[model samples]
Target: MSLRHAVLAALLSGEYSGYQLTKAFDVGVANFWYARPQQLYLELSKLESDGLISGREVVQQTRPNKRLFMVTDAGLAELARFAASVSKPSFIRDDLLVKVQAVDHVDVAPVIAQLDQRAAAAAAKVEILDKILRRFRGDLDEETYLRHGSPIGPYLTCLRGRLFEQEHHDWSVRAAALLRDRATRNGDPPPVSGQSR
Candidate 1:
């Protein structure tokens, strides 16, 4: 999906400045889509131009003037229409998976380190998502919420992101395990052997 659509979806929450939208995207929408602040800024300008969103300047004395955006009726109609359209599922575009596919011919240490990093990052993200889940649960029960939630997409996406991060952590743990096991199965690194590199 386009960042325009993502921005539009964000605007569905309420009016938000570009800065606020960036935070919303990072915290909520990053689960499904990734975009830089510049990209979001560009898209916001485009959406304004397209009449999908309306923006007003917010005066600030000490800081840069902010523009708060509210989704227009046309935007809402477009979103509803987009929702009615069938969407293809996202497929993986992971370099790590590609690396894993070719691990046999490569050194294991750096890759294991990289996976370790990914796992750590995922763990941190999962903690943040857990907090979101708590806030999500603060409202109605699951049945009622899912049926009539104000905006369930972010909550649902966080669930998916939580799972996705967990999978990364689990896979990294297993990959690291396999790498260490394989190393142990080898000639034992010559036991350090009092040898210099």
Candidate 2:
């Protein structure tokens, strides 16, 4: 999906400054769509120019003035159109996966190290996403929240992100352990201490 649509969808909650939008994208939107801060700023300008969003300057007494933005009527229509369109299937294109694919033919030490790193990163993300999901649900239990929550889209997406990260962490740990076991059984020398490769 285009960053255009992502930005517009983000503004659906309410007005946000460029900085606020970037923060929102970093936390809430990063799961499904990844955009650099510069790219987000550029897309905001383009959307404003196209009349898909409107911006107003807000003055602060102790800080520089900032422009807050909200999606316009045209932006909603564009989002609706995008929602109605058929989505292309998603595919994985990971360098780590490529390395894993060739692990049997090459040195497995580096691949195992990378997998361990990935497992740690994914575990961290799972923890973060779990906290976010808790915040989204508030005092309501998961079952109750699914039946009665407002603004469920973001919560649903966050749930998907948590699940993906959890699975990734589990798989990475499993793959690393399996490789280590195989290396040991084959009498390959252990990876040197503090050696990532």
Cα lDDT of candidate 2 equals: 0.90
Best by lDDT: 2
Question: Worst 10-residue stretch by lDDT in candidate 2?
Answer: 188-197
Question: lDDT values of the candidates?
Answer: 0.81, 0.90
In model 2, where do residues sit more than 4 Å from their true spots?
A: 192-197
* Cα error of candidate 1 at position 97, Å: 1.1
- Deviation (Å) of 61 in candidate 1: 3.5
- Give the runs in model 1 whose Cα sits over 4 Å from its true position: 139-150, 188-197
Q: TM per model?
A: 0.88, 0.94
TM-score result, candidate 1: 0.88
Clash count for candidate 1 is: 0
